[model samples]
Target: MASWRISGSRALLTAGVALTAVFTATLPAQAAHAPGGVDDWGTVVDTKDCVQADAWLVRVKGLGKIIDTKLFQSHYPTTPQAPKQHAGGRELINLAPMGIGLGKVSALYSRAMGHAHPATTSGKGDVPARGEVYADAGGAAVDIGLPYIQNPAGGTQLSPFGVHVEGITVSAYSQPGKPVAFTGGAARGYISVAGTRIIDIPPIWAVNLGVRIPEDYTQAPLALATTNEQVTTDVKGNPTKGPNGAYKYDPKATSGYVNGIHASVLGTDVADVTVVHAAVLRDPKITDKFAVAPRAASDRAGVPARPLSKSCAPFAPPRTAAAGMKDTSSCW
Candidate 1:
């Protein structure tokens, strides 16, 4: 079983009209590529990359212009993951509030527990032996951190940020009246940030942060059983039994972490402003044993499928707003 939770604080930030207008007008042209021919996601293709080559950088700058700098100041901590030097000595704040969401999918596996019984005879009087049965079912599920923020009008904003997870899939390969080797489905997920937050002002730029879940999957069940007796009660508690020990099933659970922030801006001038910076704190630990395999659909018919694993890297945070101005003297 899995559960979700969300929480956090609020505030305002600063921005101006002139800065907004220039950012809006010139950004699209500059966002075509990165300094070294890198794409918006930070995949550097070449070295002589100009601002026009970095679409992600341009978007972040535009969004930064719309953020309220003041609101962000209050949330600034002395030691942040992103050093102040990277932000031009200005406190980089997170504007979004933190929240979480959880979901799960599972199914019964065995219909009968491992146990043999003798048949009853009608001649004189003999009670028949009843064999134990267990349920056999399994599925996948997910959990994520939902990033939220407040607009100038006092309305709240929400989006998926931080880390995300996919539950393991399960499969059993055995016939009735015989022992079978049970294998669980694959599980996956990853940590990430929103691209929009890296900007000095978020409204001016539209870049977004993203992380790809590994194509690797877990094949071992979170737990397993050998016989009806073992399934009934061996270690991890009575094997999720059903009504009067009539049936039993495997028990499973999954968890992960999320880290990052959100940004929003409102105002006409570059002077007066408010900014909000929200930080995510998470500590994840794996307490059980499981098998890991490359994410790929099994060719066997009737088996659950999974996507193949591929290379995926997170994009680098954008340069600070002050640095953007320094990069383009003409804009200042």
Candidate 2:
């Protein structure tokens, strides 16, 4: 079982902690539902599941390292950050977002698994990689970036609940590669109806979604690629290639940024929908979490997403960007 542990304690806050809402038994059973052909056994949902995959922002502190270390120590194809190195057949260079200055990559995986602590064991019975190996972050207290839950392959446990929604929405909040107690990262969203329980979490340690081996690490954050159309971006965050090239991206060898799987949720009635809120980080002392909780289905009638999150002010997207840029800009 490949795993890592935060032996060094630093009172980190747990993000998206479930404050305790009424269980599935509470929600109204009114609306007509559709799984959109999604299959369910407990663990795996079939192909056509409908979810409102929301785009999340990976915010980080101490990002000025890029401006400082012109070398920008980068090592993706897995390593979040590493010193610039080059050789003949054994050369490598990490790209931007270099140093885990943000935090540990495990934070992202832990979030998707719906917990704050990194697991010592893999999801299935997968073998463990050496535990001592660690990722390099520029000393951030935390970081995060993307989704999932695994149920048994055959079972009708989900049938007991009559309040089933179309499908589940998967989300992951993550950090860089190493956990710095002060920095933070998060990605949170609701799954209308997925997973056996409310947590609706999935394992990122061992279960393979699409990442390549060696690079597809056990503690690294991951997402199930929703589409096959790969879009490769470059050091400047520009489109440089297509169909994700080999993983374990070699900076001095090839384009730096390893193609990443960007994701979002899809479905109807997401306004006040029931979602699993599990942020891997968020120090209890630091109540001011930079990220927002996943929105509930808007059609939930009078139900409020937060107990008293102030009256709903109109959500306004910033209009300051170029004319057409507003559409793609984040709502935050």
Candidate 3:
């Protein structure tokens, strides 16, 4: 039961999101390899290691410009669990705005939230919210962020920045403010809306998504429906049930840091991580499509069919629902 998000403070600081308020959208998918031969999501952890390779993105939000590695620093070092440094500083390489001393943390708030607020102090250690990650600050993630925005004039506008997400293989790995921690699960790889079409626009595009590593079809953060529209965490790590006494779905996100793309918002839309694309990165790369139903038919062969109902359970052989409404006959 994901609802439209309004409050940001009450949500879990690690990868908060309630993005379902937006309309129907589908995103794209890309590669299966991490840049520079980086192994799974668990590797290269440490402030310095994060600063070296994972901190900066090869792609920039704008053209012919290079984004420094400092734009993705975890702003909540005060939080207990944040690593001294994180992979890619936890953000895509983009030229987001920030105050002078803030560096990457500045861009982190700006991008995760939205444009630097009108009253924002320029080149200073400040966070300008726009009903987004920090709504009270005036950020609303989509209302004023990127890839898509509904203007005060009732029209559509694109984000100016070409935001990008390499991919996700982590889930609430660590609760920020606690200390650097991995959820100790094998939920690997998810492709979300990586690159936006404009410069200065946050990567919050029409669609966002992530899929488990293809090698293990029955991975954690399972799919909500047979469709690619949503991602969920099944019985892989810890399953949080919905109001109906069933497991809730989450957008398949990688990091839990406040500025992390997946955790910036609040609610179940980020119950996991929002799917920015139809990420089927195991093999035979899809046309890089957006969210679509019956993804099992289009995905690589040999993979098990995903749960097709809101119950979040695996389907029985033949993948059909039972006749009655109380049918618990399928993947339970």
Residue-pair clashes per candidate: 80, 62, 66
Which window of 10 residues has the lowest lDDT sum in candidate 2? 131-140
C-alpha root-mean-square deviation, each candidate: 27.3, 24.5, 21.9
- Which numbered prediction scores highest in lDDT against the true structure? 3
Residue 176 lDDT (model 3) = 12
TM-score of each: 0.18, 0.19, 0.22
Error (Å) of candidate 2 at residue 64 is: 32
Model 3: lowest-lDDT 10 consecutive positions:
130-139
**What are the runs in model 2 whose C-alpha is more than 4 Å off?**
1-232, 242-262, 269-332
- Tens-digit lDDT track for model 3 on 10-67? 2221121111111111111111223444221211222211111111111112111222
**In terms of TM-score, which candidate is stronger, 1 or 2?**
2
Candidate 1: minimum summed lDDT over ten consecutive residues — where? 50-59
Error of 1 at 158 (Å): 9.5
Best by TM-score: 3
Task: Note the Cα lDDT for every prediction shown.
Answer: 0.18, 0.18, 0.20
**lDDT of candidate 2 over 1-332, digit per residue (tens):** 11112212111111111111110111112211113321110111111211111111122112333221112121111122211111111111112244332111211111111111122222311111111011111111111211111235732122111011111112222212222111111122111223332222122211112221112346333212210111212212223333574332221211111111112222221111111111112121222232223323232223222222111111111111111211111111
